[model samples]
Target: MASMELTDGYDEECFRTIVLAGSPQELRERRIACQSILLEQLNVIPIEEWMFRVNTMHDLIAETAVLICEAQMKEAGYGPPPCTYSFIVFGSSGRQEATLWSDQDNGLIVEGEPDGEKNRYFEFFGIMLSDLLEEVGYEKCAGKVMCSQGMWRKTLSEWKEQLKEWRTQLEWEPIRYLIISSDMRHVAGSTELSALWQKAFYEGFIDNEELSVAVLRNTVRHKATLNLLGQVLTERFGDYAGGFDIKYGVYIPLVNIVRRLSLLHRIRASSTLERIEELERLHKYQHLDDIQRAFLLAMRMRVNTPFSVQNGLLISSDYIAESELKNKQLLSELRESLLLVRRLHRALQRQLRSAERWRT
Candidate 1:
């Protein structure tokens, strides 16, 4: 986690400067400046280092937002937090796999029982944090999974109860929520509360074959990126016309595959690479090395996808442009990656079917 803090010029002192910025406009500019530095190093460095650098800038920006939000509340007469609570991030941020243009996938896990004062305080905090994040440039989650939502902002005990109810449902939407929560990681506030929340979540898998299979069914369903003739499938029309969806087409499919297998084995690691390593350590999968290589490519190629700079912030369609895909060598690499994803994707579908059959 320490590595998530500083990267070259972005040290602790640099973050302090951001925290101490005179106004929101200054804060946003400082963040943009940092991201510009990352943009400069993109193709120049190893994909792994570039990814690390990108996430590092995101972390600093988020932490600075947290500090500023608290100060803003105090200045507005909220005092310190009424109780112990945590600011937790979900999805890409939680997994430490966020790209430069990542959205707000976060929540609040407050201590103690759910009540009026605590709820109101965190609601205000959530709004401020989300606005601050957007001001410096992370888009709000289109799905409304952010902390500002009443569903996501809850007391620690309330979260456990919700998890329990979701676990018992064994239906599509609840299972989806369960899967989403699987990626939860504490970004700020009390680590103990976060741990307690995780303990509730990960423990739900034990003796829960029906629930696991439900998740597996969701995992196996992915967009086909290659045709039967082994040609790459590009977006046929619209703004992203003829562009390859490196995100869902390759990266997310691969992430789902790794996440499914890890959860099946009861491995609780969140990030794709970490789950692969953990699975490898336990001798869980035969094609993990190939999966790792393909996933790393997906990560790089996803970041390499076309983005436009508006207001000095990246706005991406998450598509690898048709013009860029015309390069024979790059197309060949993409085909190779998609082929692996396709193979493993079919393999997992077969596994899911087999598991269902045996259950009957």
Candidate 2:
């Protein structure tokens, strides 16, 4: 990314090979190879560096895939892209926190009017790219956040209007979209367009006093990971019964609390760690060390959660195993993290209450 000077088991050569991959199949093979290498060094590398490596690999694969897709489009008679476009990602991929098994959460932002010709061309391009990525081991997003959907593949102007529509509603569904919008990151093409898309999103945010509260209302809808007695909550029943829902329980609650605080403090960052750092700088979040500590642990546990290798793809589950839960060190760290999450959760509740009173 910044430079190809990676060290300590992060194979710069493998990463370069991914960039040089000739076909989607080549990329897929390279990705599988890279995944093997990373898994072997999973515990050896720190989560921070591991995350950097994995997500950077994702960026390169996606970028190279874009190049291949563009050439294919030309060969298939579509000519060039017709206009500048940005390939953007959402959720963990957007925040640069993708684990080894993260799925696709992406969109295409085109640089022109919503004309029939451009739309038709990019629609084909979108489906091709999505299919290629799936072939490269990324499962399509279940919610259809991928660019194959017209709702996600839009002209820049159309995207702005969509943002406005989401902001205006402030309902649960629209609020969720607004939160997702905050995580958008430009992976390929037209970084300038990507910057503008994000700028418009936040610029509107600066004026919408009610928007943050609406976001807060939505942010607090997380599943609780800790009980009143400061106990770690595990799944009561299911395939993962007795195992902790590391994703929803610990990771997401922490993410949501920090995200809401970031919005309130005008901290414009997609990465949750970056948001926490800025909030600390602003003195908006005092529990900085704890937050970072717990967050890293949460990420580590999330990545370490049970995963299966099926079809050369790392299929990850969001829950830690009940057996793994017995690790004394892990339990200790998790309890501390959940406690901080609980504290931040209460803090967010207070902010929402105050906002509601202000409205009253």
Candidate 3:
């Protein structure tokens, strides 16, 4: 398909005109049309610019979903949300790094107590919003992280208490939740609620050594994709045999390391690139330019392919057919990127260890 011409630039007005121009059903259809334009334009735009475009498209979809939920609530006589709430997205969407077929990972933070009536109201709207999002193309999160889930949709005090529990427990599951919650960004509704949630989360890590160690442990849990022989590892078995798990094997480790360091540095930026830039500005890390370039290259590769959900997890293939892998130049670039990931991982580990020593 020929790429869409970008004459007027990507703005909210253009987004509304294209994706929100018609009836509810028609709006859902138009949202997919907008995605098609974005996918096509992905081929021509710079990787960074393309990522921004994708995020904007996601924001538009979420806003439209919120509108749908509002309409539904009005029809049911709920009369909009009872209390101020922030629709917060986590994972890639939260970091403004969504790929072409990203699934939803979001939740809600409402002001005041989670009374029975108010809880029911938000719960109904949450399910409505998730359903609308799925209809428009974004898949529901497999982890049940969406606002439709009771565990995710909570009052501000409830969320603060939850964070405290996670910090106190410091178990594997709780630590995992803490890390995931770290990436949340406010998509709609009250920004104050979102800020309060963030404050609670960041404060949990302040001068907390045990929490820092838990984060470090989780951050290094995954092994790099490159083996000791420096060969890129492919899936040994499965439908994706001979294909690389780029999402987990490369992108995730980089994200984890950057996120951990960002938290340690008290930088609140969620995007991996943004965290790296902040670390560089703080003179905290060395050779950030190369690391950023490699990270961007990996992102470009992942976004170039269509994403799929398998076993309820979002997966993308990095499979270069053996025939294609025989192309010396292409092979070299792929190997170089994988090696850079390994190098960056090692560098991050060293920095963390050094920080631990300094802390003592």
Candidate 4:
């Protein structure tokens, strides 16, 4: 029988080398290798420990992948392409809150003619980068909304036109498009691209007669969660177990509402929590009281609960039964805040309907 030799501290040294000190290209390769190692070790460790290891590995890997792609472009003599391009990450990645299964949602913006070949080059780069990511275990976006997808990859001029059309039209499809576009954040590429487009789009869209209506109409798409009498229909999957799909149900709604408000006020912040804080400082929207703020905080906390797949899957959260919340006063405050948000949603729906009538 062959005896296995003990390799003391080998794993720790490997983890540090891969996640922290390596150059961009080396980090990318090492991180991918670390993921494979963690996956193989999953059966030997407890689920909770495995979750921590995998998530840490993933965070480092994602950052490394981005860096490596940038390095590749620089090495190709493109040297960051142009000063007027931006890599905008949308959806979960934009929020910096990703689960193991989350796919990519990203776009690219280059300041150039809409129909030119430069735009094609940006698309080509994005496609190649996304293909590499897929090979590293980060699956490509299923809806074809990634930067590699023509629908998302565009020149700055093209995006501005798209935004203009959506704002002017005030139709369902246009509104839906804007909703996704609104949540975008500049993750990489030309730094000023995001700010420039944001300035133009906000100036053109906010408080516009047609655009406001479009946004309000889009807000009501979450109506299925609102029961006949206007109660929030909590999901059965986690409610009985003292949990909820905070991601889809509560967090998404909060984010959507913030999206509408930010668009209305032309708030430039991307994340919901940041938008709330920024709006509070602006002092224009005083509807969010301390109680409401606390509620939003609680909801945000619930939304950030971590999860991972070990054997089958493991999801964990700060979610507790309505009766089990430790801070009763805090919970009470949050509940009130949630009601305020509900009212806001209703008011927006009414505004949209009125606008529709006026337009007709």
Predicted model with the maximum lDDT: 2
Comparison by lDDT, 1 against 4, better one: 1
Error of 1 at 178 (Å): 1.2
Number of the candidate with higher lDDT, 2 or 3:
2
Q: How do all the candidates rank in terms of lDDT, highest first?
A: 2, 1, 3, 4
lDDT of 4: 0.62
Every model: Cα RMSD to truth: 1.9, 1.7, 4.3, 9.2
TM-score computed on alpha carbons, candidate 4: 0.68
For candidate 1, give the lDDT of residue 42.
Answer: 83
Tens digits of per-residue lDDT, candidate 2, 1-360, equal: 222346754588779889999899999999998888888878797777788888888999999999999999999999998889999999999888898888899999999788988998999999999999999989899988899998899999999999999999989998898898788888999999998998888877886888878998998776877777887889888798999989888888878877777777667788888887778777544778888889899999999999898878888778999999899989988998888877778777888899999899
lDDT, residue 110, candidate 2: 96
Best-to-worst order by TM-score is 2, 1, 3, 4
Estimate, for each residue in 1-360, the C-alpha lDDT of model 4 and write its tens digit.
Answer: 012222426456656765463354465456556655665664465433444455455545655556666667677765665435677777756644444455678788878676545755566578767876665556677777687887787778888888888777777887787777777777665678888877766788744766776677778665344455644444466444533344554556667777777777777776565677667787877565642364345444453455454433234543444344345664454455456556776777787778788889
List of clashing residue pairs for candidate 3: none
What range of 10 consecutive residues in model 1 has the weakest lDDT sum? 1-10
lDDT winner, 2 or 4: 2
Each candidate structure's TM-score, on Cα atoms with residue i matched to residue i, is 0.95, 0.96, 0.89, 0.68
**In candidate 2, which residue pairs clash?**
none
RMSD of 2: 1.7
Model 4 stretches astray by more than 4 angstroms:
1-64, 70-84, 95-101, 114-120, 135-137, 223-243, 290-306, 310-338, 357-360
Candidate 3 lDDT by residue in tens digits, 256-343? 8779889998788878888897899898677678767767877876775445544333345544444455667756777887787777
